[model samples]
Target: MKKATIKDVAKEAGVSISTVSNALNNSPLVSEDTKNRIIQIAENIKYVPNMNGKMLKARKSMTVGVFSSSVSGHYFYILVDSVFKELRRRGFGLNIVINKDKRALLSNVLSKNFDGIIVFDNERVGEHEVELIVQNQIKTVFLDRDLNGADVSSVLFDSYKSGYDLTKYLIHLGHKRIYFIEGEENTYDNLERKRGYTTALKEIGVEIKEEYFFKGMFEESYAYNDVISRFRLGNSQIPDAIVAANDYSAIGCIKAFSRLGYRVPEDISVVGFDDIEVARYFTPTLTTVRNPIARQGIRAVEILMDMMNNDMPGVSEHLAGEIIYRDSAKAKVL
Candidate 1:
């Protein structure tokens, strides 16, 4: 005789395949009488009770995956560290994968390995490019940038608020003309942070001239070269202060400023975001926003566990960042 199957149990119970599954899993929707009858029929049919089989029926694979665009950066290292820590604390081993190319990243996500995935990558990774993330029925949580219309969980730094706060700090110190150094144009945080800077300037009755805005790559060298090239071309008028998108870029600005015989916070005040480890130990410690880097990792695991266990509704969380005051910024004394 052929082995009994879910179909056999469903047929024996005179119900649909779904009804039999719900009965076997003890889902609250099933009536006590129906559940008891289904269990009796499953037993009589010699159906073996297996937890793995139940999980399979529920479309769960019992594993989690995390991705970063590239594993070469300091921020990526921080994010990976936090994610692993949290996942392990929750008793879930994590799979860390980096997709060097954007196209391949999408392809990897389309090819499912485990249950859910969390992403911490730059904005070059688009919402449409990640449509495969949703189509695969894989739960997602985006760490850094906000992907519009992609229905997924996110735990990101408050970029707009951080920018506004940082700019306000500079302005309050009597700096009027502030040079704004930005990240990639396609990045959401870059745009939001710029918006905050503009908003603060507008509120303080300061006019923002196009000459003071500079866009550079995420690398310190890129920002340093961009600033150096622009400064060398200038006719002696420079902004009184500078706001960098991140600590790496800020370090670049500092290096360029020093080479040009300009002192930070004395010749020009500077501020940065995502206060990475090196920010604190630098010559003139960086005044920047403390992004909840490690906390996001812990939270991702908590959310993933909830997702795996069906503990809560689809949750989206936003973590806040606090600005750390240090010697990099100073009030201009009359």
Candidate 2:
């Protein structure tokens, strides 16, 4: 004889799968009478919840899950490493899942595989999914976007202010004709950074030219090719300075300028955000905004632990950035 599943119990009780799940988890959304009916039906059918679900009910998984879109960059490496060390010190384990499929991501999240989750994939987990997670009472800390819920918190970098300040600094260095490189479209950090750049330009009475904007996709090679192609086309005028979305893209822009026989900060100044490990080691040494990557991870863990252990309400925290002046950029010679 085959064992009974939640779906089988739901069918027998004529209730939704979510209703069955809520009843089993003792969620308050279901009425007392409905909850009792579901429980009785589940018992009659011998329905058995998954082991992870059982752990969730008992609240003893002793682990956290990190859901990310991609974990290949230097930024993610530092963030995850910090989270790992912090969790280890507290006697907990870590699980990382990288998936682009929203359905699979949702399933993994709802599976209760971990006690709490730290989400970095804004594309996969949007407003609707977040609501479902909250309904299920999963403690979550979002790294890439800002959201507040009963059990959801956000830890974010102050991208807008940093971008504005960096651009203002460039303008102060006597740069007038400035070009901007963009990251992936519609991302929270990317959007905020772009907004700051444009705001700074407008405040200084500088015209924001659409032709000066180029897509770099936050990748070094993409930024390199974008720069090289623009220069090779000969249709666009060379700007006095260029601002890239991140350090990797900035380094790529530098390499492209070098290949075109243009000297960095001599022929054209350049700057980027996120002072990654390689920023200082690059030939010209990138000038950038230092994002608190490790601190973000550490603080995220602290907040999640508080929610999971102490039953604290979620809160939002914003980390600020610092300007790191380096050799890659300089004042324009009048």
Candidate 3:
């Protein structure tokens, strides 16, 4: 069995190699009938383009490499979706590389034959990873998280503001001694959100309590157990409300109370961040900071394209998170 090439397709179609190339690349010079005939012959011979070799020869892959944490029901998915759409619109292809470990992520991304790369959830990135990325000399843009030492383009969202504003809103509703459910320990977003929470409490003359915080529990079962443990341990003061780092944690808190025979906003108010799609459809719609997850994706690609064109200037961009009020949170009574 012989591998087919442009020459083979051309020979089979009784046309020149250039004609085959033009047809495959969708060049306008080839007639519609000729293009169809060439494509049919290539298909019959199972001739697919060798992108890897082509990229090597061209010295520019014309493809953007995307490094995502995961492509499931996470915030990263929203960003990846937006980037894919924007890359296509800009006439560039995309490649997604997923790995949680910094070393592995960097190895996979840097080794790939690509012109540019975008890093999502930058918390996993380390100094070594930074060195790798910088050493590669590839155009790069970071989304959702920032690299401390990387002197490159980034599009960020104000997680701190999201946390601060949401907490402040709860405080204005008379919530004091608010409990904070944190996100993953190493995540930059979690740290910023906590800062915002602390800032709000400080502004209201309310001191943050060590006992009012919990960790290692981001899911519904974890939240329910934490609430139960607090009750069983005779913890007298249940904060007026619980503020989660994101909507998933917030929803978990709500479910915990519901199972324990408590009503939301009526018994105790709760607020979450990110305002993921499920927030709106919850039993009592969530009151959260509406993170522009999808838009961030779209902007990332647009910026990366600018970087690709050598027109990218040194600039840091941040998108504000909007607050959406729903039935989940309410002012506490004096």
Candidate 4:
């Protein structure tokens, strides 16, 4: 059967093509009853509006949206900056949104206000939201989400390896009393990294200490508070080292530890993931996992632009993390 057109909808509804157009666009010129009749007829006949004409009328915006669950912290800022630069180089505008609510995020994405969108890893996004992406046929590149669906592709980081490699390195340094600053326990990155940490510890016969684990919200203040609270709870001795989920938490731990007259590496070694810029220049210089943050940004944009321009699904990638040793952590002394 031939694809239905506005004329077909107009004929089926006993209305003019112009009226059908108005109804399809939800123009107020059509009465509510008439609009509903036209819409039902259009749906029945599978008629689609002339989006190309509408797009041409407005002109290509060359704009894309980038949504992140949290926009603060050095990690996100660095990634945003990199993504911005990449988009700028390609003559595409980048609109960044901090997704505070999943419902609102899905609404904006489904609105088709941009050519395409890149979604950073978000635990708040559920299966229903992913189905919306498929339902609307939105061109989306998911950063670290690894969602499986039509018109939804992903860019992933090997977070489990990121955690395991760093943890194993700390173990190699003879640090058995390793405390963990876990970030958003429910998040995929945190879970993967935690697995790696535990795996490395288990291999070396070091039973993971439950008391040494602190919950983190992937922020500096939370980590800072947790460290301070532990000290106030009559803790005089420090763990051999603390492995934080991210650089922000690690920095917070280092600051809190420093304020308590504890020197990093000398008093308590610290390790972090995501080698943000400040991590390399902090007081003791953080030892961290180089998370390819900039590359992640660049890759996200590349994939998004490819999908937008070629109308193709971009290939997914799983990048490995590497340990970058610095002054923040040193071999434990026997």
Task: Go through the candidates in order and give each one's C-alpha lDDT.
Answer: 0.76, 0.88, 0.75, 0.79
RMSD of each: 13.5, 8.7, 13.5, 7.5
Q: Name the regions of candidate 1 deviating beyond 4 angstroms.
A: 1-61, 122-124, 147-151
Clashing residue pairs found in predicted model 2: none
Off-target runs (Cα >4 Å) in candidate 3 are 1-59, 121-123, 148-151, 216-218
Once model 1 is optimally superposed onto the true structure by TM-score, how far is the C-alpha of residue 126 displaced, in angstroms? Answer: 1.8
Q: Model 4 over residues 1-334: C-alpha lDDT tens digits?
A: 8977788888888888889877666677988899778866765666644444244124277888887677877767888899899999999898887777554565566557777788874665655566556655677888756663446678778998888888888888889888889998677788888888888888888887778788777889999999898886565567999989999999999999888888988978899988888888899999998878788889878877766676666576777888888999888888
Clashing pairs in 4: none
Per-model TM-score, in order, reads 0.77, 0.83, 0.77, 0.76
For model 4, the local distance difference test gives 0.79
Off by over 4 Å in 4: 1-61, 121-123, 235-237
The best candidate in terms of lDDT? 2
lDDT of 2 by residue, 268-289 (tens): 9999998998999998988999
**In model 1, what lDDT does residue 41 have?**
88
Candidate 3 clash pair list:
none
Best by TM-score: 2
Give me the runs in candidate 2 sitting further than 4 Å from their true place.
1-57
Displacement of residue 26 (Cα, Å) in model 4 is 16
